[model samples]
Target: MEATFVIVGGGIAGVSCAETLAFFEPDKSIILLSESSLIKTVINLHAITRTLTQFNIQEMESSEFSLKHPNITVIHDTLVEINDGEHYILTSTNKTIKYEYLCLCTGAQPKLIPQAELFEEIIGIRDTDSVEIFLQKINRAKKVAIVGNGGIASELAYKIKNTQVHWIIKDKHISATFVEPGAAEFFLSSLNKDVQEEQVTKRMRYQEEYSHRSGAALGPDWYKNLIIKGAGDLNIPSEIKIHYETEISNIQRSNNSPYALEVTLSNGDKFTCDMIISATGVTARKSFVSKNELELSNTGEIKVNEFMQTNLQNVYAAGDVCCANWKLAKHWFQMKLWTQARQMGSYAAKAMVGHLNNEEVLQDFCFEMFAHSTKLFGYKVILLGLFNGQKLGTNYEILIRMTKGLEYIKFVLEDNKLQGAVLIGDTDLEEMAENLILNQIDLSPYGDDILNPDIDIEDYFD
Candidate 1:
């Protein structure tokens, strides 16, 4: 079997690449091989700012890809080996397919806690199945411990009610992956806030059935609708105890306590919980590709250039599976987020098509700045550029404005130019903030007036 283009992995990156390819090159044959029977598709894509986007991810039947694109064929198969020299790949089912262009979107896997023996008692929430498993465990759990300082850990700390949460973070504050100490303090108040009654609003949906294999990592808003509750009744207010600047020293099954497990923290504190959710983070998944066949980064990620092309001819990679080895735009940095996955996938498709046509292709404008939007503790969170003054050393100024329980806005200014911003709540400053950062407008003359309540920053910018 052969095709003009063969994409491995059915995550957002692969599906988006295939969709874009079909739209641009209708005559070319494309084959999308996936280990999972279900594929993820992004819907309701909304451009909140030039670089920031909001979208809902839907898990659809793999057959939908072929039905949507007459030139594209979807196959449920696992990629086993890639023969770069022969320009062919071997599948797990003993099938060989040759392609002129190959894109690998095999995303990353969770970096679980380093206890090999207690793997069954720990859960790393990445995909739908993992979330289901977490829900099942929490239903019968009285107390659960979560380890990590990233998005998943932060969200779980706030969303998991009725169960006492032992949020263990190696950082001094919460949500360190997205916000600073001030913002973390702002979010601290919401952790124990009365749980809001469930609302029947539109939300991203998930469907799962026994298939040939598991599906891709879930996209944004993966837990928006799910009923995340614990064994305690509704009247009991949520309880969360944060262990800052510490990590898990050891974990073992409890002998005398009623709890299922005993966890010892690096600070010499010990606690017993029913289970532990390790959101420690993810590492790139590159085990399928032989080291001799592809150039890899020091961190085991496939190394790709600006065009998303690998060292091997006709081979490319995108999303979490690959690292951006090229010089990045000043304001843009890479994060293993769904937004970046979509952008990388789309850009890779254009790059591939341009290579085929011998046409010059420029980098996408979205890469000019880094932006992300997510909800934590029921508040809208927007991050732009170097929001926390990353890489700026100690030579930056921060401006902040806060209205308790309403909004918290922060701006990172370097040499009077907007370098980054964190807009929490519905501050309605994302567009203006993005423009200020992109245009490098100097706001020195405005002084503290920029964040003054009386002054409309947007109007001044306009």
Candidate 2:
């Protein structure tokens, strides 16, 4: 087997790269290989700003890749070995495929804590199958212990009902991955509130049998319509007890206790729960490729330059598998999110096409600023640039405006210039805020009036 381009992985990054290449260079042949039959495809793309984008991911059949692009072929196979010297790859089924250019998008896997004996008791949610397993376990669980404070942990903290939730975090506040201390405080109020009935929105749902092979990470609204209730059928409001500045020190099954297992925390607190969820985080999946073949970061991520090319000629990597080895823009930073995966994949395709054609390629504008939109506790959340004043030390000023349960808006300013912002709820300030940060417009003349409720910020910026 042979092709002009061979892409490994069927996640958002690999799909986006293949589609972009097929569209730009229709005469060239492209092949995509995946371990699973389901592939992630982004749809309903809306560019909210130059750098901000909103999109939904659809889990499509792997065959759809070739159906959509005649120049591309999709194969359901796992890459077992890569011979970089000869530009050939060996599949698990003993098939060898040669390619002139190869883009690796194998993505990352959940970084669970080292617990070899308790693997069955600890579950890490990453894909639809993992979520299904979690739901099955929760159905019989009266209480569960959740570890980590990222997006997944935060979402589960709000979504899971009827179960006594013991949320363990190593931070001073909750949802520390996305927001600052003040925003975390604002969200803390909603933990014990009643779960309000939300209006259902029309969206496509894809169902398939769970496979042992790891699939792509679940997308936005992954828990939208899922039944997240636990076994305990209490009429009272949901209970969530947050243990800040704590982590699991030890976990083991208890023979005498009523609960299934006993967990000891680093803070010397112990609790018994029916289940334990480890959302600790993810690490790069680079074992397939030999360490002697390419250079990798200390964290085990493949190192890629500005053009997304690795040290090896004609080899590139994108998505969570690769770390940005170039000097990033002031506002742009790397987060292993779906949005960055799509952007990097598309940009990598352009770079590859340009290199093949002996043409010069420029850096993508999306890398100029960091922007992300997501839902947190039923509220629309938008993060832009250095929203939490990251890397700015203590030389930054913060202005905030909150309207009870309606909205919470915050701006991070350095030298009277907008450096970042956080908009929670329907604040309708993302576009203007993004422009202010990108253009580096000084807001000093407005003083504190920038966040004044009476002022029409959008109109003023216009």
Candidate 3:
């Protein structure tokens, strides 16, 4: 009898798993189920937009992969309950599916803040519509305030122009993930100066009065010209703003106009503002899955092993929804990254196919690499590895070479084995550096050539 395989979640994780399973088990039957339509507009409209930048955005190409396939059945419905035991599996949609193997590539959902009431005053931008609405508000208002300190916040802060940008840095610095201290400092300096001074605004960190002060010769009246809030921990030279452990309280009508509103901080501090934006970051959404079937973390992430299998036997999980093993360090990362989800789904599919053939499938061994590349205000930022303490293990030797406009850091072994690294502004050496890490090359003979800025070192990996 031919085996039937059921894959849940229609996003990158689900689709990629199906693709992989199709390649591994050509004769097996496959079925896919999802709540949202598998369309670009639906993704850009509802899901996080960063998915476009992180993975092969070309997959968004309409003609690429369809939910409908010869050996696949795509169901556009949410999963309410799941029953997987000896032979048969049932879904809440009343669709009974019997599979030799099951893959739970279900992704996560956005996190809603505890006190979402305060967001009413802010110009939120989680999607295209939100961004458009916020832009309209910015064209009219002079000042803008942003919430949270993460990559999203940093991206918004770097994009502010013309209006005053107020950055509320509850934390000490910007994204703790991608940037090293030196590069982060430089990136923060690249923001618009006039905006930070007159058009830019921010909350005071600790007892310091200049936590968000502008270095320009502008006076306090600059605050009257316009106000803006940027999301993230912004570094302005030698200043730091620490909110400690305060949260937003509430937002109310300005009493004069519908467009104006008052923002209340958790500490009872009240401020009247024209607009606010919640760069507060997103959370994982997993409401589609029945809580009783599989285990979920308090943070909304799904639990899975290295093979992407959940607590339930025969059911596997992957992507931003599942916990990831951070490679090179004793840390774990969970988020909505397309590449990670796709890879995990692929792995799960292979393992499932192995079950049918009674063959042991190879589980993933390497730690997860939480790297991303993007341009902020014309400056290019590329993260190659996780910052877990393991990246700096005593066994690994870190070599850094810095020039005026570029920076390169390579992780080498005492025995010359390439481990990992972070490369910024060095476009020419990126491919070579990546090859070294991927191939785990032995650079013993190369010696100083590993850091050489000019020659092509692609052959070293082979």
Model 2: per-residue Cα lDDT at residue 336: 93
Please list the C-alpha lDDT of all candidates, in the order they appear.
0.85, 0.85, 0.53
Candidate 2: regions farther than 4 A off: 116-119, 198-213
Please give the lDDT score for candidate 1: 0.85
Worst 10 residues of 3 by lDDT: 200-209
Tens digits of lDDT, candidate 1, 1-462: 999999998888988898889989999999999878777777787766677766666667767757778898889898889988888999989999999999999999889989735557788988767877888899998899999999899888988888888999999999999998999999999999875753432223333332335557766566766778888767877789999999999988899898989999999999999989999889987657642468888888899999999998999999999999988887889999877888999899999999999999898897889987777777888889999888789999999999988899999999999999999888888899999999999888999889999988788877
Q: Clash number for model 1?
A: 0
Each model's TM-score, in the order given?
0.96, 0.96, 0.69
Compared with the true structure, what per-residue lDDT tens digits does model 2 show for residues 59-148? Answer: 667677577788888889988888888889988899999999999998998988676246586889887679888889999888898999
Clashes of 3: 30
Global local distance difference test of model 3: 0.53
Tell me how many clashing residue pairs each candidate has: 0, 0, 30
Report the Cα lDDT for residue 125, model 3.
Answer: 43
